[model samples]
Target: MRLVIAQCTVDYVGRLTAHLPSARRLLLVKADGSVSIHADDRAYKPLNWMSPPCWTTENTEGPTPVWVVENKAGEQLRITLEDVEHDSVHELGVDPGLVKDGVEAHLQVLLAEHVELLGVGYTLVRREYMTAIGPVDLLCRDEQGRSVAVEVKRRGEIDGVEQLTRYLDLLNRDSLIAPVSGIFAAQQIKPQARTLATDRGIRCVTLDYDQMRGLDSDEYRLF
Candidate 1:
């Protein structure tokens, strides 16, 4: 990873245009070719970022650093460094990846046991249903016996909706699961993401983790 603190300005042109005026900011270049600019605040969110699957050209031959980054879609981000404050590179070892909590992984288990939460007559075919891409959070059959693919997240974002859409596309290709539908389940879903999921014909479900747990306990108590 390369981190550079410099006085720079950034311009991005693609589906939309954005500009970051000159200021002292942190420029992060990852091993995967992704780059992000960060202000002193906003915690984890970057002022601007270009994900991997992009290419970057750097010209240090000049008085200051200049980088031109382009993604596969031909979207470009041009960064012009006027003055360098600090520059350093760190060799961070392999990442262990995100560690999900009960709010994420365990919720899948609770939802599987109570498939009715999805809708009446919904029966769990399995949890962690395998697909060409990855394991779906839950797979079930609806009231009409149609296959349903549920993607559960702690917090639903646009990407989570996109992911479920991909799984649905792949599952629908299988004759056994053909005509498969999708549900985006999360404790909290962004309004924009919900709108996108709905437009894509995928249902968005807002989950109540504690309430679901309470309902599950009630079922066990009755049994």
Candidate 2:
């Protein structure tokens, strides 16, 4: 199945009923003879349309939300729950692990660039920091005597900010370093997470895959 964002428009009924800012129009074309329009980004509600036999809905319980349906000619259609609530790009069926890998790889490049851009001396303490809570992506120290912990996420996984915050708290309590700082790096951040980071004065950086892979090594003097 291939999911594409066709366009975005003001959904008056959705705006009035659900109050979402804009309704993103999505087109899902399957290798089979099934095609669908996902609206409102929610999966709990059954899909009811004017055309009978053209669509039928079925709900099922599992690790992820599952909606099974059949088309006019009895073609099977499966809509995972995450598809409606979260961006389909982040769905399990999608390349979520690949996205995470891409984000982490990009973060490594950004860390090197940040040190050069700010003209500050820094050292990477650990690339992947393992802890009781979980693995923190990057741990570094800056010239200004500050310990920095960075957590990175891809475009779809902006929820990493909270996880980074928790790691920051742990680092402050467990490490000898004073005035520990946190960095949240991602391809994109959710509005709520971005607002929270700004309010807390956390350093946030956004990096796309291309930016990560294209770091200029010769421009920076490495100590």
Candidate 3:
């Protein structure tokens, strides 16, 4: 990644803006060795750079230090208090697919363990299995000959309900499996969606981040 510098401005009242000029400039450098100056406030927050220590140190009547130098290999760039205002900007430009892949991986492990813990006689049929409907995350069969479709969403938003609903619809339409039941698992669930799901008799479960991360070794047996 190449280093470049760009300019930015701050309007929001926060730790980074308490000392610097409200309308100061910021320098932004792209990884591809390109530089652009942005006067817009929205463009700065996503940069993922920490606010310079000068703002905090100066506020306490400490020494007014010089600019901070961040060295990457042989390249060095000096970042001032004003430049650190946009540290989170880089995350905004990340690939959405990479985020999805990570969420899916975590969900796969959790779902497997959850099934075993329930002591339900179920068989893990497929993972990330492609069907006429789409790519179903996990497809399993309970001992009672009922097909269970599980979809995992990391963020646990209400949107996951709609997604699972679609999968259910596809399963019914395609006649993929008989007596199908769907489970939508996430870290959290929207209140309204939870009510709606309950009313509709939909099986929506909430699994926290820690629970997903703590699956036992036997959980990997499905893989």
lDDT of all the models against the reference?
A: 0.84, 0.54, 0.52
Off by over 4 Å in 1: 61-64, 111-151, 155-183, 190-203, 208-223
Best-fitting candidate, measured by TM-score?
1
Off by over 4 Å in 3: 1-101, 218-223
| Superposition TM-score, candidate 2 onto the true structure | 0.47
lDDT of 1 by residue, 1-223 (tens): 9999999999999999999999999999987678999998988779998865679998899887789999888999999999988999999866543456867987788777877867768899988888755688898999998999998888999888877886786787799777899999888999999999999999988888877777644352111
User: Residue-wise lDDT of candidate 2 within 75-121, one digit each (tens)?
Assistant: 44444443343244333342222235655665565664554332357
Best by lDDT: 1
- True lDDT of residue 194, candidate 3: 76
Per-residue accuracy of model 3 over 9-117 as CA lDDT, tens digit each: 3222333332333344544544323232344476333433322111211132334222332323222223334333343335234322323667667766667645653
The TM-score that candidate 3 achieves is 0.48
1 or 3: which has the higher TM-score?
A: 1
lDDT of 3 at 151: 75
Ranking by TM-score: 1, 3, 2
Clashes per candidate (backbone, < 3 Å): 0, 1, 16
> Judged by lDDT relative to the true structure, which candidate is superior, 1 or 2?
1
